[model samples]
Every structure is written in C-alpha cells, then in structure tokens.
Target: MAKSTTQNIRQIITKRFNGFFVIMLGAFGLLLFFLFKVVFVDGPTLKADASSKYLKERSIEAVRGNIYASDGSLLATSLPKYRLGMDFSVFKTSKMRDVFQKNMRPLAEHLSAFYKDRTADEYYYKLKSGFEQRKPYVLINMRLLDFQERKTVLTFPVFKLHPKNPIKTGVVFDKVNVRYAPFGQTAYRTVGYMKDKVRVGLEGAFDKELAGVPGHGIFEKMDKNMWRPLDGNKEILPQRGLDLHTTLDVDIQDIVELALMKSLDAYKGNYATAIVMETATGEIKAISNLMKNEKSPTGYSEFVNYAIEVSENDPGSVFKLPAMMAMLEESHMPLTATVTTGGKYTVYNKTMTDSHDYGTLTAQGVIEHSSNIGTIKLMQRVFGSKPSKWYDYLRNFHMLDPLDFQIKPVTGKPNFNVPAKWDALTYMWTSVGYSSNTSPLHLLSFYNAIANNGYWVQPIIVKNATKGNEVVIDYTQTQKRDSKPICSKETLDKIRIMLKGVVESGTGNNLKGTPYGIAGKTGTAQRRVNGNYIKGTYYVSFIGYFPVNNPKYTMLVAMDKPLGSSEGTYARQVTAPVFKDISDHIYARDMKIQRKLSGYLPDSLNNASLHHLIHPLDHSILYANLGFPRIEEDGRWLSFQLNKKEVKNYGLSFAPKKVANVVGMNLRDALFVLENQGLKVRAQGLGFVQSQSIPAGFPIQKNALITIQLH
Candidate 1:
C-alpha cells in the first residue's frame, strides 16, 4: 500500500514538470522570431535614428577674399577675433584649489589693471562665487578680444598654471570673423559694404567672386550643449574667395578727394563730385562724391556716386564741344568764319546772349568765349537747312544712349528727337547746352574722346579679378567697348585747338598762367527744378585735359548749388581753380609726368634749379650766401617770411637727424625734406601732409619708401 501511494505522487510531480518545460520552450521560440525580424527588417531605420540624435551636419564658413588697390595695397580684408571665457569648475578640483588660494588676489588685481573697467575686489568675489557654484562657463570679458589678446589672457595668473595645455588652463574662446578696412573713409562708397543682405560698390558687384563657396562637416554633441567636430569624420574644405584688383590709385584718389573737399568748403556747396580718367585706356584713376550732412554744422560725407548717377539737367557750356564737333564735320565750316554778337541776338522769338559782348567773332571765338548767341547762329547756319542732321550727328556720337559702365548705374539718356511743338527754337536751345540731359561723366567722355583723337573708349573702374595667384577674369582681354571714329582726325584736331584757345585767352583764361597747358571748357548752367529753371542756382563745372601737346589725363570738377554771389558762382571762379589745383599737384608729384618733363629739359640743366628751392636746414647757408642777415628763431624747423626785397628766416633749423614730423608741411617742403633724407616717397592728395607712414623720431632706413597723405 505505501509503494503504490509514492508512485502516484511521483507521477503527478513529473506531469507538472513536463508542462512547465513545454511553456518555457514556446516562449524561447517567440523571442528568437522577434530578434530575427529586428536584425533583418528594421536594422537600417533604427541605426539611422540613433545616428541622427548623436551626429549633426554643420556648415564651415569660407574665408572672404581681400580687396586691393591697383598697387596691391590692402583695402578690405577679414580678420579672426575671439571672445574670452573661463571654466570656473576647474577651481573645484583638488589640484586647482591650491593654485586658486595662492594667486586669486593677484589675478583679480591683474584683471582690474588690464581691463580697467572693474574693481579688484569685485572681480575676486565674482570669481570665487563662480568657483563655489561650480559654474561651467563664465564670461571673462564682454568685449571681443583679438587673437593676441586671447593668447595674452592665457598667460594670466591662474590661467598660466598650465602653460601649454588648454584643458588644464580652463580658458575658453569663441572665434568669429571681422571685416576690416585699412584706409578708413577713403573710397568708402566704392569699397562698399553689405547692408540688409544687399551689397554695395565692389563688394556688391563681385559678391559671388568675393564671397566663396561654403563647405560641410560633421559634428558630435558634447557636454554643456556644445557641439564639436567628431574625430575621424569627413570634412569638405572651403574655397577662399577670389581677390579683386581694382583700378583705383590710392594716391590719386586721395588727391581728388582733397581737392573736391576744399572746393566744396570754400564754395559752401550742397554737393560736389570729381573724376579723373586715363584718356587712352579709359581707366578711372580717381573718383569723389561728397554731400553736406544735414545733422552737423560742419560735416560733409560721401552719400552717392553723383558723377555717374546724376544726369537730369543740361550740361551747360561743356556740351559746346560736341556741338562744335558736329558743326565742323557736317558743315565743313572754317573755325575762322566770322559772326556778329552785339551783346545778344534773337532766335525764333527767343533771345540768347554771351557773358560779354564782342563786335565780331569767329566760330572758334564762339566756343572760346562761351557765346550762346554765336553758337545758336552757327547751329542755325549749319543744321537749320536739314533739322534731322543735328539729331543724326548726336546719334552717331552715341550721345543718345547710356554709357553702360560696370561700376555704377548711369542715368540721363538724351532725347534728340523732335517734339510735336518743335521749331527753330529747339535747335537753338540744344545748340548751347540746353534742352538736352547729360551727366558729368558723359560730358567728360566727350572731352575724353577729343583727347583720344575721336575714338571714344568706355570708362572702366575694375581692372581684373584673381583667385590666389591665378586670374579668373581679365578685363583687359575682354571685348573692347571702344567706338569707331566719331569724326575725322582733322575735326578732332580743330576742336582741340579751339578748346586750347578757350583755356589760353578765353573763358578759361584763369588757367593760362599754369606751367603746363590746359585745354578745357567752363560751364555755368541754370539748375532746373520741377521742369522749370531755378533762379540763382547753377551747376558750375570745368572739364578738360592737361599738357595739350600730349593728352594723358582727362578730369571733370562739378559743383551743385554753390553758395555765393553770381560772380562767385561762375565756373571760371569756382570750378576752374579746383581743376588747376589738382592739375598742378599731379604735374609736380606724378613720376610719369616728371619723366615726361625730363625729356623736355636738357640733360645738364634737368635739376639745375633744385638748389634755389628752399630747405629748412640750409636756411642760414642760403641767406649768408645771398648776403642777407640771420633772422630770429622760434622753432626747430625754419620758414621764411618774404616782404618785398626783405627776406627773414623764422627759426629755421637743419634737417632732422631722425625722421622728422612733417604732418603739417606743404607738399613742396615735405617733398624736399623727405627726398633730401635719401628716402623714396609715395605721396597722395594735394595739400599739407595729413599723415605719414613713418612716425616722427624713428631712425630713417635708406631707400625705404615713405607714404605721405595730404588733405
């Protein structure tokens, strides 16, 4: 009976064990099926999801290219700057605790002295509190510091504990780029800037070339929400932008700006513009556009490019050149052909007059004297027979179209078509610089054409563009925009001769006494407002070239709303002098012009008159040799006060043993001293020296080129 009962219990136990084993096997099989599905069917999707959370694609900004002047001087560039930070958590470490205790006070004091914006005690408390709180990152300086400054901060007391190890030093830096201009406010408009995503000047025109391609890189998320480049990740290197080599000559630009500013100030003008261009190549050497600031009592700043942009009004007497060219070519009229001008003459019920009256004048005298009546009468005689011929002449000269310059937009397309109400009066009005709209640049191009012997070349501002050392765009090699001969060489020569007469003895006679010959026209036009001529407001201008024997440069100076009496507002009085000032300075300082002068003078006498030129150090020697008495001394540098036959030296001394302070010396005196010191000079602008590359009292290096800026 006992054996039978034990057997029944064992059977029950075995049955229960077998059922549990079967359930366990079924569960294991289901787990294997799900694992296989996950490994094969959903593997890529899950892996991608995980990677997205840990890795990110980031942009690597390209380094912007530099803008350089024609001579390779840096105009605009990008520099790297840094904002400094500190990890106060470093002081919580046991090793840093001793360093903090020993140098905390000294570090605070150094911070106070270095930045000068906070107190030592305040800095100490702030640093101590940050360390106690275990602050991960604390700003050390709000103002961004340069690379050198960042490196310097690394040498500061507590930061110096680990000289070469960044992690140990606990110093942090955020790097950024900054656009820098080496020449402040010089050609600021032309150099341009990016505002509201819109580029201006060269920066805007060549944005694609100047702004390089952006690259891509992989970054991994790090502690404190920081993102850093992941080790072994691929990166596409960014391409640096191409550099721009503009046609601007910094020295000539300085001169043009100074001359324009002086004229604007002297005349109290609302605005002024000046441009200088190479006649043969059409390369713009210098350009200036200045406007009066309404907010300041004595502030003038650059606003827009008026030389190329403003083209709403008639160009005044400067237009006479084109009219004269047309008449000479079509009519075959001699320049000596005579006409009568008795103060004024009537034309188609309208009256025209000259500034002054002459009994009888030739066609050449008409332009020379800027006689409106004479020009109208010549136009009537030449084109009145066939009125369409005048329009055809202007069309052939390309005066009816835009110049289409690459640098700036040009306005003012002339309308030579006859109006419905047109009559003989229209011809007369358009003949003497009225009833036609043009810009100063357009008029300059006309005069430049004459200088180029009738071939009109399009003006160019940018010379070329380069990537690294390879040129990507060569403007010189591009298709030339030069026009076919606008007229025969004979007509060009005749008009040029007449223009010379104007400068020599006619309206531009104020420029007659200059050492070099000037050939240009003076213009005084009534400013039109709301389609009506405004009284007493005029646009005064002078346009021409120098050394008429061989034309090299063509310049234009125009002033709008010059504040003065009627006589003071004339082109001869206001604009011609500015031209003379620029021309005289360029003639004296330009090495090319100097070389040209060398060919004219005999070799033996090339520098003969140089000694007569005064020198500060040689004052005593010069006066004693000339049998004059020594004068009083007031300063180290000597100057002379000449009154009649009496000559007196006012405290003149010898040349400075070291580099002298020539910041206020005139061009002539500055050139003498600098050249006498055996230093090569590069001078800009026309006036007293405003700045010098080499500071005063530095040892002069032989043959070193010193740049002097005048204003």
Candidate 2:
C-alpha cells in the first residue's frame, strides 16, 4: 500500500509541473495578441503626416448656406475663413539648428507684429504648450483675420516661405465657412442668433437644409511627429448646404425697424413692437421690436419682437372692434342705433368705466369715440347673461388659443379662468378686448380681416421660404376665407367708415391728413399681475389700415409700459404717428401710390397760401360753395350729375350749385361745381381727397368748402 501511494504522489507532481508550463505558454500567447493589436496589426491609430508617416487623416470641410431676403438681398451669408495652426514638432530639428531657429523666430515675429497685442513670445509659448500636451495640431487663431488681414498675413516674412522653403516644416492651415451678418444690430431679434456654432431663425430653422454634410479623408503619421495628407488617396466629397431665400423684404424691414426705434425713442419705454402686412395677400411686409435693457434703460437697447411677445395684458378699447362685430353679426344691430352709457356699468360685483362720458351716442359714434362702457352695454344687450355665446365667438375667431410661430416662446397666449363660476363680468370685459391676452400679431390680424373686406387671412411673417434656390416651405392663406362671414359686408363697411372717421374726426383724429387714410382703433389696457392690476403698467397700441378706401396695408404699433408719461393716450400721440410716418413713406416710395408731396407744405392752407403741387394736373385751391345741390365722395361737387330738369326754369340764370356735402367726389366733378358755384375751382394734384376744410354734413354757410382739395 505504501509503495502504491508513493507512485501516485510522484505522478501527481509530474502532472502538476506539465500543467503549469502549458498555462504559462497560453498567457504568453494572449499577451502577444494584445501587443500585435497595439503595435503591428491594426495598432491604435494616431493620425500623422502623409508623404512621411504610413498613415494619416486628410480633413475636408463642408460649406454652409447663404440667407437671402425676398428681393434677393443678402441678410446673412457664410464666407470661407481659415483657422491658422502650427506644428512645432517640425521645428524640432537638430541639424542646421541655427537656420531653423532663425527662420522660426522671424515667422513668429511677423505674426506678432501683424496681429498687434499678440507678441511673438506669447504665440511661441502657446505653441510649445500644445506640443507638450501632445496635441495633433495647435490652433494659433480661430475665426481670425478678415479677408484683407488674412491676405496680409499670408505674405508675411518667412511665414510665406512655410510648407515650402525656410523651415520645411509641417504647420498646416485649414479653411472653414463661418456665418456673418452685415446688418449686425438691425432686425437681430427676428433673424435670431447662433448658439453652439449652430445658427437659428432663418439660419437655424432651416439648419438641416442649410448645414452641409461632413467629409472624410486619410492622414498618415510622418517622421517629424506630424500629420500630412496622403497623396492620391480616395476622397469622400462633402455636400454643400443649400441657399435659403426668405420672404423678408429688406426695404420694408428697414422701415419697420426705423419706425419702432422712433416710437420707442419718443415714448421712452421698456420696449415696443410693430408689424405691417399686405391686406389682400396676408404677406408680412415687415416686423420690428425693441427691448430696452431695464438695467440700463437709456443706453442699452435690444429688439424684443413684441409682436409675438405674449406677456402683455389684452388691450381694452381695441378689442371692442371684434366685440361690436360679433354683436352686430348675432343681433343685426343697426349702425345708427343708440346706446346709453352712464359712463360706468357694474356686472357680478365688477365695475367697468369708459375713458370719458359718451352718453347716448350712436353705435357708430361709440366705436369712433372708443367708449368702453358703450361696448359692454352692447354685449349685455346682445349676449344677455349667457357667457357661452361670447366664448363661442372667441373660439370661432381662434382668439382663445395660442399661436404657433417658428420660435418656441411663451409670449402671446390668452389666459382665462374657467372654474364653473363663469359670469357676465368676464363676458363684459371680453367684449372690450380685455380680461385676456393677445399678441400684437393677433390684433393686427383681426384688423387685417376688417380691412380685407371680411376675409380673415392668417397673418404670417415668413411669406415664402426656399432651400438651395428651391422653395421648401410656404404658408397658405388663412383658412377662414371659406367659412361664414364673421361680419356682414354692410357691417364691415360701416366699421370701416367709422374707423376712418376716428382718424378723421374722432379719438384717432391726430393721424388725419396722413398720406394714406387710416382706419383702425386705439387701445390702452391696464396690466394685471398676480391677480391685481399694476398701477403704472399699461399697454398702449394703435391698430390701423392704410388707404382705407381700398385697403393695401394693415399695421399695428404697440408700446409696452411707456415710462415717464402721465397720459396713457400716448398710443395715439406716439403709436399712431409711427404708423402715419411709416405708411406715408412706404406708400409713396415703395408702393408708388402717389407722387411725393412737398415736405414744406401744411395740411390747412388759406387762400393766401399759394397752391402746393403734388402732381402736374392738380393745384391746391380753396373756395366757398354758393349753393347746395349735390356732392360726391371725393370732395368734388357733382354739378355734372345735376341737369336742367333738376335745376328747374329759374329766370335768375342761377349757376349750378356746388353741394356742401362734397365728400367722396372725383376731381373733375369737384372742379366743375367749384367753378359753377362762383367759387375758385382749384385741384390739389392727384390722390384721393383725404381732407377738407369743412366737415361733412355741414352746409357751406361762409366759405366752408374753401379748403377742399385732393390729397
């Protein structure tokens, strides 16, 4: 038994020894496999210089797209700019050390001299740090050097001899495209800014189409510890980004920007916004917003794009337009119907008051005068205590919902409380365009509908968008065109007339005699914060359409919290003037509506005031009507419309009487009536008769038609 045990122990020892040897061999083989992956077979790849190293990466950059305006003007564009770099490893030469050092010193010196403030020592240290860090290529400057500076740097001392003569080094430079906006501060808000090397607005919204595809290349590690492109290697070309064309008219944008700036300057406010749109096409001609830095109110300013900025309380009087329209549609109220305003009304414990006591005025006059109490009374008479119809109208008009524009923002959304205790107070305020929120764009669009003859075109800023010279996106006109008329043509016409009257002789009369007739409303809403009204916070706005007779453009100007002003009626004195100034300039210059009127003339000229001419055939003249027969809408007497039968057989040989209600008559008939009425017939050079000395409905008792003339 002992002998057998000894034999087993010896065999076990021999077996163990052999197993240990085999295990050691297997471990060695595994180590060799890892070593092969690192050093020989598919080794860890560190890019190097081609023509020297066995492998390297050659990089090719992609090109970004250009942004163009509606008229093909350059708003933003991308230009090829090079990022200069240096490979100091190439300067690590031992032979001819003096020559290499000499060449490099001058190159660094030249760079420092040209860049000013950047010395040779600083650049050298930065390059050395890059080398020590084992960086593949060191960036000396990024987005550096405009076109001229870059050209100058390329021709600098020994730098020009680089990658060629003096040092025979491997300091490679690369070029890439970078976006640039020429009109830096203008319309920056609407155009937006870039983040994380990516653009927004027209640049970012269309980034995928605007950003080009990246390319790939091979680089080899060379002998001088540098990377160089491989010669004649296969290349994958990058796709160029598509150019984008937008419907933003540059000229109109300038006008809008200027107007907003002027309004903000005059009002001394926190911010202001304005937008203009073509009444017929729903095309946004221009949009501008100014945001004042609250910290530095007077010195620092920015564009806030207040049109879409929704953080404002709903306007009070301006909202009355739609409220009255809804009431007219539902109740068919006559324009001449009378409403009594005791100056205030109480509903559900809440009291609403008018700006002033406009007691027992016609409905049309209430609108022209912008009576808050009048509108509430109208709503109560029509909707009664039922709040459902008011809300239904709001929904039908899409006023209750938030707008979805290109930017993701919290600016303009209406807020209404809904918790079962819905009352008449809410409906009353809603009738006057308050108790909810609205964007300037929203109000402008509503007025645009009235001006568009009841066709509600959805207001859009981006009229047409193109990708790489191809149209990729465009908005359709408002879907409300096919729907039922929100207001009857007759009601709309009456409202238009009233709106014009407002500018002519009502609350908005400050804008009268403007180059184009303005038809819209004014608004001043007290801002509420945290369930309480802010005493000093008010939103003042003027929403109107130009050329009211045949609507062309509708614009809205809003001033948010205009500081240092006691009267909130600043909307007319401040906002309305902006619309007037811009409309006059745009209509005359771009639209070619009428010849430019002499800037030196006054609206009301006396007989002593010589005839101011706007065109060749017309002259400004004043006359008194001798008798009342008939008149036309264009301020011309309709003497031709009257005949011998109408005149009767008067032996006194009475001349044809010029009608004193000479409103809306053509120039030809007006001249005839003025001549026949024993009054001097003079024509103001061609345009619609926008103003007159005598108000309509007033007889020419004493030379009342004396100031009648075409605009």
Best by lDDT: 1
How many clashes in each candidate? Answer: 5, 36
Q: Top TM-score: which candidate number?
A: 1
Which segments of candidate 2 are over 4 A away from where they belong?
1-62, 88-99, 124-136, 162-171, 197-200, 212-235, 293-303, 406-408, 411-413, 417-421, 467-469, 472-485, 595-711
lDDT of 2 by residue, 1-711 (tens): 999999999999999999998999999999998887767755435322223255645556677767666666566777666656665555455653344455655767777876566889886677557655545567666545555456666675445665345234534555556666654444566666666884545565667766678677786663344455665888788777776665566656666766676567667767777788888876777777777554421222454556775655667678888788778778888988898987787877788877678779888888888888888778888888566777777666656666565543454566655526565477777777776776777777778888887877665555444555576655453223425555678778777877987888788898887655778788777767776787656778889987877788888888777776556435677677877878877775553354455565443432132212121111111112224232223422222322322331111112223234344444433433343343433334333355556454443332233555554
Candidate 1 per-residue C-alpha lDDT over 1-711 given as tens digits, one digit per residue, 9 for 90 to 100: 999999999999999999989889989998888888788878878888877776788887788899987777677888888766666666656877777867878988988877778999998987787677777667767676666567777778978878778756667776667776666556777788777787777788788888899788897654345555665878998898889888887767767777787788788887888889888888888888888664421245676777877466678888887888899999788989998887888755777777788778999998899988888888888888776777778877767777777665535455454544567688668878888777777778878888888888888888888888899998776625555788988788789889999998899999997767899999988888889998788888999997677888999999988988876798999899999988887877554543333346464543342212233444554555545557553325665454444565555354454776677676646755776565666766556788999987788765678889877
Model 1, residue 17: distance off in Å is: 29
Each model's TM-score? 0.74, 0.71
Query: Model 2, residue 88: what's the lDDT?
Result: 56
Please give me the total number of clashing residue pairs in predicted model 2.
Answer: 36
In candidate 2, how many Å is residue 634 off?
45
State candidate 1's TM-score. Answer: 0.74
Error of model 2, residue 32, in angstroms:
7.6
lDDT of 1 at 379: 85
* Model 1 error, position 670 (Å): 13
